[model samples]
Target chain A: MAITVIPRGDVPLGQEHEFFKFVCPPTFGGGPVDAQPATIKFARKLDVMADLPLPAGVKTYNGGNSLRLWLIADPNDSSSNGATFPAKTIRTKKGDVVWVDTGFSFNTHTIHWHGIEPTPMNDGVGHTSFEVSGNFTYQFATNTAGTYIYHCHKNTVLHFIMGLYGLFVVDPPQGPKFAAANAPGAFGFDPVNFSVPIDVEAAWVPGEFDSIWNDLGHNAFMQKCDQNDPAGAGTFTQNGFLNRFRPDIVHITGVVSVPGNPITDPRVSVAAKTNQNILVRLVHAGYTVQEYTLGLDATVIGEDGHPLGVPPFDKYSFPFVIPANTPFRLTSARRYDLLLNSPNAGVFPFQVKFMDWINGTVYQTAQTTVTVV
Target chain B: MKRRDFVKVGLAGMSAVVVGSMEIPPLFRCVARAANLAFDMSFTEALVEMIDKTQVYHWLFSADAGFATTGPSLPGPTIIATYGDKITINFTNNLPQPHGFRIVGTSIGTGVIPNVNKAPANKFTLTFTAPPPGTYLYIDPFYEPVNRILGLHGAFISLPKGGNTPYGGKTTPNVQQLFNDLGSTPQFPGDPWLPPPANRSLIWLFHQVDPWFNARAQAGIFINPDTLKAKFLPRYFLISGKTGAFASDVPNISIVGNIGEPHLIRILNAGLANHSPHLHANHFYVLSKNLVVQNNVLNIDTFTVGPLDTVDWLVPMIRPPDIPGLKSTPLRQLIPHELTTVLYTLQSPLMYPMHCHMEMSQTAAGGNYPQGLITHMIFTGDVDKVPFPV
Candidate 1:
């Protein structure tokens, strides 16, 4: 565990207590553990560093200084401060019965839940089971309700690009209501009537940060192999430059975005009002190939966590529409959801881009804004 | 290669088989059978062989002499068609440079088809008309993606004109026989793999090989699409073109099936990274992505086919939800009653694996860990003892 650089301008620029936010703790909040089984915990937080704020002629890769671990949902308080970089947003509900726990501490992580489907020793998948080192829990039973993602399956490509993920969502048990004031909230899954009212939710996610593997450390190119050495523990190799993925830096839910500008981060912009609705969600936590582009007219309805046209999958699938200034892509860990609404009111411009998995080359783009009113 | 023997070896000169008891007068038997097809192909330059055997070179696609008798093929065959057929193709350019072709989500030849000379005057053709039904890729759109990652590309499919469901029209609702009757249950019996008048349809495609960018495009050199995102290094991860351990010992990249059938795979991420495959024991049903459809399909076990996407899934070869099921009430009271009485008396053929959670495509030349883009989904009760090469 030794690669802690932090010396480029001795880390300064916009610290904001290194982006705080922990809150939840009431043994996982929401009165009476939302009726019975809940658990939650989290607690991993190693090394850590957030800062972010780029946008004015954006140039990252260690300057927007990331290097993270997070997960801290108030793991027994100690003044909380897990320093978020995208390790919050869990929000359960639909059927509930969670567990999660996690814990860890130094090097062995796990927490998968990417599209949930529990059971494989609670499916955190560290070689199909076991990797938590100190804690584990994970139980599961959220039963469908869209948009998920929860990273850190051990060295999952440098711990999900060194920021062990977040955003698991779920909702639908008529909880987190949205559309304030004019009433109506609910959100996702409306196969004719389960909920989907919305009134602005957002989410985005969109990652990408390759500050040379964020200054390498947590077992960067792991090695240890012998099997009676004869130059063949599968032909041993060193470094191999951790499969070269040069993303200078591009954020979007963790903010940063300065390639072409416009991420006036009011939590990545959105506002709303015209005809209300909204929703977004997205996900694609970077490994490249993002695309996006929207400007309204979305509709997708759900994916990666179900809810599309509903019923026995609406005979075979439905919730389509992707009109306005189109584009659409998403790759690594893909998740969609969409929904938007805008009948008349302005602003729009979603964007994203980030490409380069190989040929589709739009290095970085980001942008944000939705406004409407 | 049994996707109907790779569509009878990439459509043997468009073998016009019509036969649904061909009397077709009863009001054009609900009309829908355009059929025309054609073929030829070529764009050669081979070398192939890499399931650790090495070799390399590439620039594929070759059915040539009016189809069948194939040769150069990394991902260069498959084609098929139906939804209003018509097609064509022809091609030629035996490699040395200029290429073309296109296809991606069709609309009558959608441009390219160029070929710029190599064999005499090279040749070209293309044509079109098979849009609607879904899945399409065809590539070699010349240089961008280095002539489709130095191996051209393939898969066109289309289907659905009673090709037993994969997309609407023809009274829809087959949903592959309702997901092969949820894995043909009587506590799971076989029968599910349907498509093309009932069975066999897999086409995975997904490729990777970056042998130093195909040995600098096999010596002609020239790359520089701005240093190809910093010297693109792939190290072999394929599917149709098979990779390490012969990518699950072939049958079109490891996918046997029997215990309650359920196959219909069709993945197609003509490589450039971003995979996320994962498919341990069961959980599959995604049904459509690039060709649209997919409204809340779900049942996932990891899905994220990126670069030039196109997923389709169905996999439900049933049974393995951590086994344990003879009759266990209340989700077996949440497991662990001595491991659900020892996994409820185990059974069937099993196998599993289906790798690529993007952990560096499960490694290959950069340390052969599971030999890149791994495979295997057997489940066999006896898919002819799971070996297919004929």
Candidate 2:
């Protein structure tokens, strides 16, 4: 099976233009936009290629497809930028209702707001509801301010690996500057001036790509979706390679992290001034369990979009700080918001060890530095 | 019907319904006034039937006095102790190989017991003071994941000293009152079926079984612990050693509660692979992870539980989030009224699934979808009043 880009003519008339405009409206200025039940349009891109040029070899595959939402609106800009591996991050504010308009396109796909709890109809689990064969608007309100994710829930195992997901962050009403302030005891940061309490936010979504699975066609395992063969009784001639997952390439937040080289992707390898609070939103977007070891002491304040130690929740639990060098683990779909403040200036490496699920053996280790100037 | 009768009806004709037997009594007894408690446990082997009727060999921890009887189960037995109580387990290894017991998240008896080969030596006594008030995993530390995964793991719950509340001072809403407020009377009035407010808890011990590993162990094939040569492809996923339709029927796996009440679900990922347990009907408040109380409690429908990680969730048994109500958000309006208000009435007793979000865990025997790591959270009310199917 080879990668085939859907011709522009094949798309529904005026969809690419209208939806693209809705995604990146003329009013979008890189800041948080009011979701006042906003209609955020997204069109599926199939057979999108991601080429990683590593020192050892140049690994390439169209295993990735972005939910061309608000981040990338230009239909002509189809280049596989490292930043666009997983669809660009969708940022919104609390109390905002986001109507994700997944426009009609190729094979059936549903965008599931991973951690957010919306109505079942909008939840995007095709088995529970109906798969979006045509245009469907998933509606959900951002009730909580925390880090989240959105991905295609159709044939999730394959669709997720195909890179049809991205970070979905809901900021507090005070916006991005106050994102870290949501944590208990988070003070001394000035969100207005963005100076004394400079917040260096970095989203690290570490994922692994199995080149074999990536090379397969988009409908490689469509037979499994046969409704008639609910019990999997029907004999499908193709080998069930979906069960066998062996990842060869590892990437950190879309940028491929070569074994011996420093990940210089500005989005991942972040820069911060001394005394600046570095808030790292770590989302484990891979199949394997990930163990993250940070060079600086991190006060973990949130998990799965809930700020730790915040009111109502604080009645039952409180946030605890993890000492530097201590490793913490996260499974797929787990998000942890860590607030790190460095008093001294130095280059600190944040390492992620992707291990086999059965045994805690590091299959791959990807590193991104937190350069505190 | 009485609670016991309800249990009998719910578990009728199910061969795997081991509740009300020796395996379940200890889990519900949260208030242990005794200063010290002693249990006679044996490490034995058994053939447990899966949902697909596949009889799988397992090494389990049985709460039997001796290994003379074949009473061992897939998940051993739940050991519950009040905070500050001394727990003494007279553990006997009935299996051919040496097995050891150690509690994760507790301070006492942290070391693995030495190999018990001879008669007197095989029967080892382990005494440990119940650490803090939280949930813990008691497993055979021998060979690490190999021994633990083979069914030698169980839940060790340390109840709060003063009361049923997990944190001692906190209090949950009255379940019976909540049900009454929702216009339903208790099916078994004055019956001691429901735990006291804030004391209702369920243990979900998530585990996956690899048949090849079990077969190898049964054949006496030595598996190197440091370097596992066999690829781990678990075919069966279990919640407290139960799966598929059988899991939801088990009183221990499926959560049954009244409207507006809270049920604390103590979830332990005993499997090697990570699991994301997704709950329907209502989102749960993540109270703590790995015995540490979470400062930022998140109300989420799905949360991740990594290998060997223990998470405590407080399930607020309210109306389903998608249900149309006066407080429905703007997004809720998008859902058709038939699917919301018209379909499910407030008096309806609804049942929703609590399944693993990890796509592969939804399968058993490799490709049997919806046959693994699935259970239910049922709200108790007047079921006949419900006009539509839930």
| Residues A102-168, model 2: lDDT tens digits | 5434555666777676554556655444456545556667766788888776556667777778888
> Which digits, one per residue and each the tens of the lDDT, describe model 2 over residues B211-280?
7788878787877765433477787788877665446534656776544445678899877777888786
Shares of reference contacts reproduced by the candidates, in order, are 0.14, 0.16
- The weakest ten consecutive residues by lDDT in model 2 chain A span A22-31
Distance from true position, residue A198, model 2, in Å?
6.2
TM-score of each: 0.32, 0.72
Candidate 1 DockQ, CA atoms: 0.06
Question: Model 2: clashing residue pairs?
Answer: A301-A308, A307-B296, A308-B295, A308-B296, A309-B295, A309-B296, A318-B295, A319-B295
Cα distance off (Å), candidate 2, residue B165: 1.2
Using Cα atoms, each model's DockQ against the true complex is: 0.06, 0.11
Output the number of the lDDT-best candidate.
2
